[model samples]
Target: MTAIDTPNGMAEGTLDGSMAEFFKAQTRSSAPVMVNVRTLKRFPTAGCARLEATLIQDGVPTQQGSAIPFVIRYEINLCRDGRPPTEGIDLDAASRVLPR
Candidate 1:
C-alpha cells in the first residue's frame, strides 16, 4: 500500500493538529497517543485526498500480552481547500480511495 503523507506534506505519517483534536474528541482521551497514517491519495477529479489513519492510545494495557493495543480505523477526506470534508468520521460516507 502507498504510504500516506500528512497534511503538512510530511512523510512520517503523523496527523495534523486539527485532525488530532478530532480524533481525541472521538476517542475521549487526553492521554498521549499516536496516529499511524496508512495511506493518502489525491484525486484531481474528486478534488480531494482520502486519508487512512490508525489511532493508538497510550497506557491502555491489553490482555494480549505485550501485543498491540486497540487500533481503530479512521477515514477522512481533505477537500481542494485542504480542510476536512466533515467535522469527523462518518461511517456512512464513502471515502474516496485509490487502489493500493
Candidate 2:
C-alpha cells in the first residue's frame, strides 16, 4: 500500500498492521463514523477498483451553533481475490482531514 499526505507523511509498500493503528489513533476521540462513497472506478484487474469517499463523524458539531460534522477525504485502491473464506484483499489508501 502507498499512503500519501498522511499525518506522518508519505509511506509505501505493504502496510502490514500500521494502517489500522494509524486510523485507530485518529478516531479515538471521534463520534460514530459513516462512510460516504463519492466515486468508484474499476481497474483493469479483475477485482480491483479505486474508491473515493468521505468519512463523516456524526453528532460532532464543529462550532457552538453550527451543524458541520467532522470529515476526512480519502482515496484508496482496493483489490480482492479468491473466495470469501480464503479471499485476500489489499488496500492502498491516502487520507487527509478536510477543512471545516
**lDDT of every predicted structure (CA atoms):** 0.55, 0.46
Question: Candidate 2 on 8-92: residue-level lDDT in tens?
Answer: 3233332225553465356553344554553255556655555565666545444465545667887766554422221233322
Q: lDDT of candidate 1 vs native?
A: 0.55
TM-score of each: 0.42, 0.43
Q: Stretches of candidate 2 above 4 Å error?
A: 1-30, 61-67, 81-100
Instruction: Name the lDDT value of residue 37 in candidate 2.
Output: 52
Top model number, TM-score = 2
In candidate 1, what are the lDDT values of residues 1-100, reduced to their tens digit?
1243344532334455887677656655555566665446665534456777676765444455443345677776666566655534563554555233
Give the worst 10-residue stretch by lDDT in candidate 1: 1-10
Query: Which residue runs of candidate 1 sit more than 4 Å off their true CA positions?
Result: 1-31, 45-47, 61-68, 84-100
The TM-score of predicted model 2 comes to 0.43
